[model samples]
Target: MADKSSSNAYWAANVRIILISLVIWFTCSFGFGILLRPMLSGISVGGTDLGFWFAQQGSILVFLVLIFFYAWKMGKIDAEHGVDE
Candidate 1:
């Protein structure tokens, strides 16, 4: 019925958001910090190579930002689905 479809849509949206966030976190922490380090070496941040900065600090900062983003996004999603408190 319509309610079941709405529930499915809500869950689908939620999962999509989770997947996107995880991809960003993984790309920042692992892809930039390790896989792309050599390519980013030419760039400098705070007296260190960009890659090192990502490994040491950038990823953590990105995670915190993502946390806030996820919360804000989910709030909107919840409201749309009539699930917000």
Candidate 2:
């Protein structure tokens, strides 16, 4: 019973991390790239709007960083639960 509860807690934490990561991914890619582009247009990057950068490159970079961050964080979590691969 105790082991089952511990496993449930670990899985819950993993799911929470994934959900938060997805939210950030959506906000950066869709929110800033498209929906909020106009609001960010005032900020210039190489004579182009920051929105364009975010739409094109910024979000990709952010996603890559998030991938690494998630991997590292999850590794720590797995180790904490003694289930690391």
Best by TM-score: 2
lDDT of 2 by residue, 1-85 (tens): 2388778988998999999999999999998999999999999999899889999999999999999999999999898887876
lDDT digits (tens) for residues 1-85 of candidate 1 = 2398888999999999999999999999998999999999999888889999999989999999999999999999988988887
Pairs in clash, predicted candidate 2: none
lDDT score for residue 49 of model 1: 96
lDDT of 1: 0.92
Q: What is the lDDT of residue 62 in candidate 2?
A: 93
Clashing pairs in model 1, backbone N/Cα/C closer than 3 A: none
- Candidate 1 residue spans exceeding 4 A from truth: none
| Ten residues in sequence with the least summed lDDT for candidate 2 | 1-10
Candidate 2 wrongly placed segments (more than 4 Å): none
Q: Model 2 Cα displacement at 37 (Å)?
A: 0.2
